[model samples]
Target chain A: MKTKFKKTLYSLSFFLLSICLFTVPTFASGLNWNGHFQTETRVNLDNSALTWQETNLTLQPEVVTNNTRFYGELCYRRSGLLSQNNSLLASTNSNPIELNEIYLDLYAYPWRRMDLRIGKQLIPWGTGYLLNPTSNLNPEDLRDVFDFGRYLGSNALKATTYLGEVTITGVFIPVFTPAALPHQQFQALFAPEMPSLPFTVNEQKIESILPAENLQESAAWGVKLEKHLLGCDFSVSYVDGRYSLPVPKITLTPVGEKVDLLCELIHPRRKIIGFDLAGAYGGLGFWSELAYFFPEEVKVTSDLTAIIGQHMEIVTLKDTPYAKYLIGMDYSADHLYFNGQYLHGFPQEQGKDKLGDYFLGRLEFTLNDGKIKIPFNACLEVRDFNKFQESFAYLFSPEVCFYPEMNTEITLSLRLIDGKSGTNLGKMKDWDEIGLKIKYSF
Target chain B: MMRKTCCILLLIICLTFPLCPVLKSQELTAKEILEKVNSLLNAPQDQKLTLKLVLIDKNGQEETRELIMMQKGKDLRMGKFLSPASQRGIGFLSLPNDVFYVYMPAFKKTQRIATRQKSGKFAGTDFSYQDLGTQQYDEKWSSRLVRAENEQYVLELQAAKGNDTGYSQLILWVSTENFYPLKIEFYDQHNKLCKVLTNHKIQKIAGYLVAQEMEMVDVIKNHKTKMFLEEVEFDTGLSDESFTERYLSR
Candidate 1:
C-alpha cells in the first residue's frame, strides 16, 4: 500500500510538470523560479514541551508570456522532529509534498476589456484586515491555527469585465472543498459539538462525511460588482455555495437513562450577500465589510427511537439569516505603524445568536533602518459583554525581529493568554507559548 | 559714416534676434529655471523600465531586489517586484491625487495606504515614498539660484508654505549643459544634512535624457540605496488601465 501511494504521488507530480512545460512557449526566457525556506519551533509554557516544530521550503515557478501568465506553488515540509509516532498516516498528516496553487491568467482574451483566469487559485474579496466577513470564497486552512486568515486555493474559473470605471467579476467552482481542521493537538477544540441531550450519561464518537462531487450538491458560484465612488473603493457581491464548515448530524441510541450518540459532521448549503468599502481620510486608512448569511435547514433523526416516538427528530440548524461584519483602520508614520479592528464573527462560526465579538490591535516600531523591529499584537474575544469577567478572553503576543544578514530574518515571540473556562479562547488557557522563527528567501 | 552706422546696426539687430531665447534663459528667475527643468523631467508620455535596487547597511553588507516600473502621464505610476522570493508579486499603484494601494502577495489583496505612511522607507530601502513619487517641483518647492560653479547652477529649495514634507530644505546642483540635476543634499527639520542623492551616467535614450544610475545615502542611519536602470523605454503609449488594481494584481 505504501508503494502504491508513493507511485500515485510521483505520477501526480509528473502530471503537474507536464502541464507547466506545455503552457510555456519560451522556457528559457519566460520561466521564473523563486520561493522561501523557513524553520520554526514553538514551546508550550504549561507543559514545557515542544508544541510545534517544523521546517519547510516552498518553490514558486511562474511563466509570463505576452498575453498570459502561469504560476504554481509547491511546498515540502518535515515536521514532528521529536515525536516517535512514525506511522504512514502520521507521515501523510505532515504532508511532505503539497501543491498549494496553480493558475493561468489570460489577458484580454476573446474580448477587449475582459480577462479570464482558470485553474486552482486564490480569490480575495472584501476590504477588512485579518478578520474578513465578506471574503469566504476560498475554504479556511486551519492546519496552522496560529496563522490567522490563511485559506486554501480552490479550483475555479473566473472572468472579469471592465465597463468604464466599474468592474464585474463572475466565478464558477465545479468541485467542492471543505475547510481543514486544525492539527491533531487542536482537533478537539475545533470539532463540531453534539447537541445537549436530556440524559447526559452517554457515549460519543465523531465522524465526518463529505458530499459527492455533483453539480446540484457540491458546485458553487458567485458574482461581484466593484466601483470607485465617493472617494472610496466599494463593492457588492453575492455567493451561493455550501458551507465550508460542517454541521452536526447526530444519531442517538438510548439504553435506559443513558444514550449512545454518533455525531456526524456534514456540509450544508448557504448563500451570502456582502458589501465592502475602503478609503483614506486625513492620512488615516479605514475599511468595513458586512455580510448576511442564509443557511439551509438541517434536521437530524435517530435510527431507533421507538420508545420516544414523538422525540425522534431534532433540528441541528434552523433556516435563519445571520449577519457578520468588521471595521478596521490603520496609520503609519516614520518609525511606527498601528492598526485596530473590530469583528462581530469569526470563520467556521455560524448562526446569529452564537456569534462572538473580537477586538484586535497591532503596533510595530522599526529601528536602525528596518534592521531591528519590535511588534506587539493582541486580540480580545468577548462571548458576552454582560459577563465580561467570566466570558471574555484575551491573547497578547509581543515579538522582536532582527535581520542580521541579507535575505534572512530571525524572530522571537511570546504568546500570553488568560480567561475564564466557558469561552472558546478561554478553553485554551494553558496554551501559552514561546516561539522562534528563522526565514531565508532567495 | 551714416551709411556705415546703418549697416552695423542692422548686422547687430540680426544677431540679437537669434540670442533672445538664450538671453532670457540666462536671466531666468529661479521659478522659471525650475519650471524649465520640470518640463524636461516630465517630457515622456509614458515610461517603462526595470529597476535594480541594492540596499547597503552600515557594515557594508548588501541585499539586492528588482522591480518593473511603468508610468503614464505625470502622476500615474505602478511598480511590481520581480525578485527576493519573500517580496515577489508585490505591487503598488499610485494615482493622480495622492491615492495609493499596495498589493500584499501573502494576503492576496490590495490595501489602501494612508497618506502619512509615505514618510516611511520603501521596502527597507533608503528612498522614501516621497522620493519615488513624480511631483511638480515648482508647485511644492520654492527654488532660488544660489551660485554658479564649474558649468553648474546651484539652487536652494525650501518647502512651500502649508506643504507637509519630510525634508525642510534641499540644495541642488544642475548641469548647465542639460537641465539634469547632478547632486542633491537633503536637510532635516533641524537644518541638519541627513541625506544626499547623486545622479550619474546621463544618456539620451529614445530622444530623452535619463540618469542610468542613481544613489541615495542616509547619513544619519549609515545606510545607502543604489538604483540602476537595467532596461528603459519611453513613449510606450501606456493606457489608464495599466494603473488600475487589475493590472497591479497581475
Candidate 2:
C-alpha cells in the first residue's frame, strides 16, 4: 500500500512539473532576487546568567508582474547557547543549520487565488494567542510538540476565494516532522534544552509512547468568514486534520498495564474553531481573538494508558482540552504609534491539567517613519506539575531598533527571567542577558 | 396704333427693373463680410464692457455668469463670476504663444496655463481655457466663403498656422449686416465637437462691436457655463510682468 501511494504521488508531481515548465515562460513577469544576512549576540548584565546568540541569513528570488507572482526564500541559522555564570561553558553547533522555503503563487483569476508551497514555511492559523496548531518538529526536545513555536520544512497547499469583502481559504499540510517524536541525533535542532518528564522512559518503548516522526503526514481543511461593518472587523474559522501515529513498547504491570505516553502524532482528527474582532477609528484600534481545539482522540503509551485506565491521581492530567485568547490595542498619529497586547491560555476541560497556563503582554512604540522603534514584552507561565498548578515563571524582554535606511537596521535587546511561588515572587532570578544585532535587508 | 405700342413697352420695362433690390443683397461679397466683422471687432482700446453670459448645455440647463472684459488691441483682461463663490480672473496678451495666466482666489494663486491645458475646464465649469480667450477676427481665423445665407456669409475659417489653435479648427457664422460673429462651434484636438460658443451679449463698444456676453459648453460632460464681460476695454496697457511666471504663481 505504501509503495502504491508513493508511486501515485510521484506521478502527480511529474505531471505538475511538466505543466509548470511549459506554462511558466508565457506567464512570467520579470526576474528579481533579494537577500539579507544578519548576526546577533547577547550577554548578561552581571555576567552571572545564560546568554543567547544567533545568526540568520536569508535570500528570496521572485518574479512579479501585474497579475502573476512566484517567490521563494532560502534561509540559514547558527546559534550558540552559553552560561553567564560559567563563561567557559557554552554549546555551539560546529556547523550552520539551514532551512529552505519555496512557493509558487497563481493570481490569474480575479476572484480566486492559489498558493503551493513545498518546503519549510510558517503555518500560522486560528485566532488564539497560545496553544495554537504550532507543530515545531524539535526532535531533541523532551516535550515534542507544545514547547516549540515554529514548524520547519513542511509542505502546504492553500487556496483562497474572494466574494465581495470576505475571503475563504483552505489548506493542507503534508510530510512534516511530527511533534510527538522521541529524542534522536537531531533532537537538539528543535530547542536548546528539553523539558524533563516524571515517568521513566524506557528506550525500547519510546517509539510506542510517541506518534510517528516526520514520516507521518496529515491533511487539514478550514473555512473562514470575515466581515467589516459598523467600524469593527470580525472573522471566524474551523479547521480539522487526520494524522498517523508511531507504535511504542508495551510494559506489563501486575495490576494490568501502565501507559504514560503521547499518541496521535497529529491527531486522527483535530478541530479548531476561533474568531477575531477588531475596531479602528480615529487614532485608536483594538483587536482580540479566542479559539478552542477539540481532538477526536489523544494517544498515550501502554504504561500511561494503563495509568489513565486505572484513573491515576494526576490533577489536570495529560491529553486535556484547552482554549486560548488574546487581546490587543493600538494608537497612532503622524509619525508615532503605540501598541499593547495580552494573551492567555488555559485548560478548557475539567480534571485535565497537563499543559500550564500562560499570560503574555507586549508594548511597542515606533518613531521616525519606522526608523526607530522601542519594544518590550513579558510572558508568565504557571507550571501545573502533577496536574496541580503552582509557581509561575516570568520572561521579560525589552528591545530597541534603528533603521537608518531601508537596507540596514540596528537593534539592542535584553532578556530577563523571574519566578513566583504562589502570591509571593520567588528568589529564583537565574538568568538575564543584553544583546545587539545589525541586519542588512535587500 | 401708336397708343397701343407705348402701353405695352411701358408695362414690360416696369416688371424688369423691380428685380435689382433682390440681387443687391445677394451680392454680399467676401471682402465686404470680412471688413464689417473687423470694424465691429475694432472696439475702442480703453472701454470696459459688462455682460451677462448664459450657457445652455445639451441637457438644456442654462448657467449664467457675469463677466468684465477689457481688450486693448490684442491684449485682454477678463474677470467672470456666475455667482460670488464662482469667480475667476484671466489675463491673456497675445504674442508668440498667446501667453495666458489665470488667477483662482480659492487656490490663492495664479497659474500659467500651458497650451495642453488650454482645452480643460475653467474654474470647475464646462468652459475651457481656450474658451476664455478672444477669437480675434483676423488673428486666429482665416476665412473662406462657404456660401451666402440670408444677410450673412457662412464663412468657414481654418485656424491660422503658428496659431495651431486648440480647436482642430473653428467654424463661424458672421452677420453680413454688422460683421459680428453670431455663432461659433469649436472642434477639439481630436476633431470632435467639443464646445459651442454662442454670442448673447452682442453690443457696440465705442466704435467697435463685441460679444459682451458669451456662453461655451463641454459636449461630453453635459455642463454649460457662461462668461459675462462686466467691463471691457480696447488697447489697455497690460505690462509684460502681468503674464510672468512669478505673477502667475502669485
Candidate 3:
C-alpha cells in the first residue's frame, strides 16, 4: 500500500512538471514564474544538539489570460534529523514534497462586478496579526509553532461581488479537511492523563473518526460583507462548520478486573459570528476583530470506579457562546516599526484557563536603506495571576535579516520560551533554539 | 483745500481700479497655465502606460524594473511588475481616499499599505507612492507665478493647510508656450531643497505633448531614479470595474 501511494505521488509530480515545462513557453507573454530556494539549520540551546537541517525549493507559476487567472505553487522539501532525541520526526523517515496552492480566479463572469475562484485556495479571514479566532473556514497546520507562513488551503469555492463601496463574499467548502497536528511522538509527551485504576488494562486502543467528506451535512459555508464607512473599513462575517479541534468521545469498560478505555476523536459542529474594523489615523493604523463561537457539548468518560459513580465528564467546549476579541495598533517612527495587539478571551472556561488573554508585540528596525532589518517579537499570556501560572508562557523571538541583493536574504533568529514547568510555553521549553536561514529568489 | 482733496481721492480710485483687472488677468493666466499642465498630465478618463524604472546609487550601481500601469479617473491606479523575474506577478493597486494594496505572488495574499508609508520609497525606487500617482497639483498645492525668463515661467507652490504632504513647497519651471513642466525642485519641511526632478525628453503623441523621459534625484541620499515611457495610450475605454479588487489578481 505504501509503495502504491508513493508511485501515485511520483507519477502525479512528473505529470505536473511536464505540463508546466511545455505550456510555460507557449504562453510566455501571459505566464509568470517566480519562487525561491531556502536552506535552514536549527539547534537546541540547552542541549547543544542539532535539531533539524532542511532545504526547500518552491516553484510558483501564474498565468493570466483575459478574464481568467491560474496560480499554482509546488514545494519540494528535504529535512534531516541530526539528533535522535528529536521526538517531532521520530515517526517519519521520508521527506515529502507537496503542492502548496492551486487555484483559478475567474473575473467578470456572469456580471462585471462579480468574481469566482475555484480550486485549492487560501481563504484568509479576520484581522488578527498572529492568531485569528474568526478565521475558521480553513484548517491550519500548526506543527511548527515558529513557522507562521504555512497554512493548509482548503478545496473550496469562493465568490465575491462588489457594489460600489461594499463587497460581499461567499465561500463553500464541500470537503472536510482537518487541521494537521504535531507529530504523535511529541504529542504523547504532553497528553493529559486519565484517572488511574486499581487494575491494569491488557490493551489500549485509540481511534479517530474524522468528518466524512461524503456527507452533505458536513459541508462548511461562510459569508462576509465588508464596506468602507465613516473613514474605516468594517466587516461582518459568519461561518457554519465543524470545529477544527477534536473532541474526545471516550468509553470505559470493565472486563474482569481490568478496564479498557476507548477514546474516539470526533469533530463537533459549531458556528462563529465575527466582526472586524480597520482604519488609520494620521501615522497610526488600528484594527480590531471580535468573534463569538457556539460549539456542541463534548462528553468524556474515564475508567475510575473509586473517583465517581459512573466516571463520565461532560465538557462544554465553547459552551457559553464564548467570545474572543483582539485590538491592535501599528505605528512607525523613522526606521522603526512597532505593532502591538491585546487579545482577550472572555468568560474563560474552567478547564481551559490556560487559553487566556495575551498580549503580542512586534518591533522591527530597518537599516542600510531598508536592506537590513532586526525584528523582535514577543507574546505574553496575561490571564493567570497565581504564583505558578504567574510565570505564564511567554515566547520571544528576535531575528535579524540581511538582504544581500533584492532577491537574496539571510536570516538569523532565536526563540526563547520562558515560564515554569507545566505552564503553557514551559511545556515546550526543551524546544528553545536558534535558527539560521538563507533564501534566494528567482 | 477741499477741491484738492477730492482730486486726490479721485486719482487714488482711478489708479487702483485699472490695476485690479490687470492683476486679475495675471492670476487667471497662472491658473490657466496650471490647468493646461494638469490636462497634459491627466488622462481624459483612463490611461495605459508601459514604464521602465532605473535606479542608480551613488556608486553608479543600477537596477532596472519594467511594469505596465493602468489608471482610471484621478484616484485609481494599478501597476503590475513585469521584469526581474522575482518581481513578476506582483501587483500594486491604489484606490481613492488613500487606500493602497499590494499583492505578492509568493505569499499569495494582498496586504494593505498604510497611509503613513506612502511617503516611503516605492519598490525600492527613488519615487514614493505619492509621486507615482496621477498628479493633482491644484487640489494639494496653491501656485503663483514667481518669474518668467526665456519663454519659461517659474512657479512657486506651497502646500495648502490641512493637506498631508511630504514636501513643504515646490518650484516648477514650466514652458510659457506649452505649459509643460520642465523641471521641479522639492523642499522639505525645514524649507531645504531635498529632491530635484528634470524632464529630459518630451514627445508629441497622438496630438498630445507628453514627457517621455524624466529623472528624479534625491539630493540627501545622492540616489537617482530615471523613468522612460515606453508606451502610452490615453482614453483607453477602461471601466471603473477594472480598478476594483475583483480584478486585482489578474
Query: Which run of 10 residues does model 2 chain B get worst, by summed lDDT?
Result: B241-250
| Model 3: how far residue B241 lies from native, Å | 1.2
* Candidate 2 error regions (>4 Å): A1-29, A46-50, A82-100, A109-123, A126-153, A179-205, A208-217, A242-269, A296-320, A333-336, A346-359, A365-371, A380-392, A421-429, B1-250
Best by TM-score: 1
lDDT of 3 by residue, A1-442 (tens): 5356447645755565567556755865667777889998899899878786778898877877777777777778766556566543532224466666677778877688888987777888776675666677887664444565356777688999888989999999876766655555345322433445455675677787776545465689999999888877789999998865465665667766666767677778878899988777877778899887777766665656643445655353435566778899888654688999887752122123324677889999987666789999998865565653556678999999997676788999999887766554666778889999999888
Off by over 4 Å in 3: A1-30, A84-95, A184-203, A255-258, A301-311, A314-318, A345-354, A385-389, B1-32, B104-107
TM per prediction: 0.90, 0.48, 0.87
How do the candidates rank by DockQ, highest first? 1, 3, 2
Can you write out model 2's per-residue Cα lDDT over A355-407, one digit (the tens) per residue?
Answer: 34565665666654245788777767666445333577777888899865445
* DockQ, each predicted model: 0.63, 0.01, 0.31
Model with the higher DockQ, candidate 1 or 3 = 1
**Deviation of model 2 at A344, angstroms:** 2.0
Candidate 1 TM-score versus the reference? 0.90
In order, the Cα lDDT scores of the candidates are 0.82, 0.51, 0.74
Q: Name the lDDT of candidate 3.
A: 0.74
Backbone collision tally, model 1: 0
- In candidate 2 chain A, what residue range of length 10 has the lowest lDDT sum? A136-145
Please report how far candidate 3 places residue B68 from its true position, in Å.
1.9
User: Whole-model lDDT, candidate 2?
Assistant: 0.51
Best by lDDT: 1
lDDT of 3 by residue, B1-250 (tens): 9999999999999989756644544655666777878877764578888999998888888878898999887888998888766577678888877777777765655656677766667777777766776677787888888777666777889988855667889999887667789999988778899889999778778776778999999898888999999999988799877776566656
